[model samples]
Target: MILKRLQSIGMVFLFLFGLLLFPIRSHADSAAYVIDETGVFTSDQLLELNDLAEQVTNDRECGVYVVITKNMHGYSERDFAEGLFFNYDLGYGLKDNPSGIILAIDYNDRFYDVYSYGAAGDTFTTARLDSLNDLVYDYLVKDDWFGACKAFINKCDELLESTGYVYHTIQYTDPTIAPHIVETSPEQRRNEFLLRLPFAALGSSIVGGISVMVMRGRNKRTGLAKNADQYIVNNGVRLTQSRDMFINRTRSVTRIQRDTGGGGHGGGGHSYHSSGGTHSSGGRHF
Candidate 1:
């Protein structure tokens, strides 16, 4: 009975192993092409990156082919640099080169790089170097394929303004100024004037008060001038001195009045006054 129990245990272990292997085999079959150069990447590392690309392309419905060069013989350092130049050049030629994205790894340097060519008008820039590295390492290396591809595309947009690579065409639209200028009928103008009447009356009242103050000041000066002659007679002051004082006070009052009321009226009934006698005054009001 002990021997029979041992046989049963063995059978149970075999069954579990088969179950686990079945899913893995099925997954391997469904994945897109996964090329790994044994010299460049260990079998385990290749499998890991393959699984990552598979998961991402499957989710995003994108065609992804992962190529790994194990030995420098078939894919040397010169070969890789030429490959990048070729891809960039070809993309420029075909104008559709940005669709293919490459994730290249330099095992010697322990660093990886991602190059993407987005749609037309989208080009690469130096500013995106760091972000592209982050997307490849953080997302692609982590098997977040969908996130990596999306982030790559977004990085392209972020680089557009700073890239200095102008697209094929400049999009322009005519300025729409007609909407800003509305044609109002006589009735509308009357209504607009009525709407502004209260403010206009307030402004007029202010102006009238200012005018009254100015007139009162003039009247005071006139009275002072009349009394100046009396002072000259009583205090022995000169007539020339009295006349000069009256003229200077009148000139000051005129300047103040001009400063308070000299600009055009607009939608608002507030008057805009300028301090300078010349048209190019220091202040302006609308």
Candidate 2:
């Protein structure tokens, strides 16, 4: 009984070991690539590309394949052609050879092309191509691989809608004429303001000081003119009131001069006399 129990245990252990080995083999088989001279790709590169491809395919809920061709080979070549094979001679084609999507990276041109076997061909420029690669690296490789791939494909679809496939072309223009940047959220704006607050505050202080100085000079000139006008008006009013009775005295002097014949300026023998009392105006006159 003891021997039988040990044998059963050994069989159980073997079974578990085989179960573990199965996944290892399956993974190895599933991840296959075709590397060649001028392929311009390393094992790590292929692995990364494969990971992105799998992510896109898995999210679409459709079977898709990613194939990289050295010097753009697959564009005009067939899967069964000689010297055309993936890792372990596994052919590079749509899943089950059915109509599907394929993301082909041409290492030679550093350009990427997306082809829907039965639909259309879309191309990406160097910058946009780099953006797609970055999206794969950042989102697919680092974050949710499936979600990133799906989002990328969706973006490609949106691009296609506007300019068909030509939307991938890059526009070179003067940086000064570039469109206004999109506004950021309040939090982002606040952070930006804080980052630039020192310079902004310094500029505001300079402007404010200059404005205050100008206003002060203007007020001083205005006040001086206003005070002089008020003084002149007050003195004129006081003199007029104090000299009201002097008007009759001035008339009497004028009559006396007329009676003494002093009005005849051409008479050489004419004599003029002055009044003994001196009249004074209330305000000093120069």
- Model 1, residue 1: displacement in angstroms? 62
Question: How large an RMSD does model 2 have?
Answer: 41.3
State in Å the error of residue 218, model 1: 99
lDDT of 2 by residue, 1-286 (tens): 9999999988996786566445544554645322223444455655665565455434433223444444434333222111122222222234322223334434444433433321122223334434544554444334343344445555544444544432111112221212212333232344455556557656877998999999888877533343556466544755335433544433333433346534322423312111101111110101
Global fold similarity of model 1 (TM-score) = 0.26
Model 1 scores a C-alpha lDDT of 0.40
lDDT of every predicted structure (CA atoms): 0.40, 0.39
Q: Give the 10-residue window scoring lowest on summed lDDT in candidate 2.
A: 276-285
lDDT of 1 by residue, 1-286 (tens): 9999989987996786566446544544632334433344455655665576555443432323343332222333323422432222322222322233344444333334444332222333223444555655676455454354445544543454355444232121222111211233232344466556557657877998999999889877433344545445565754565433434433333433456654542333321112100011111110
Error of 2 at 7 (Å): 38
lDDT of 1 at 96: 28
lDDT of 2: 0.39
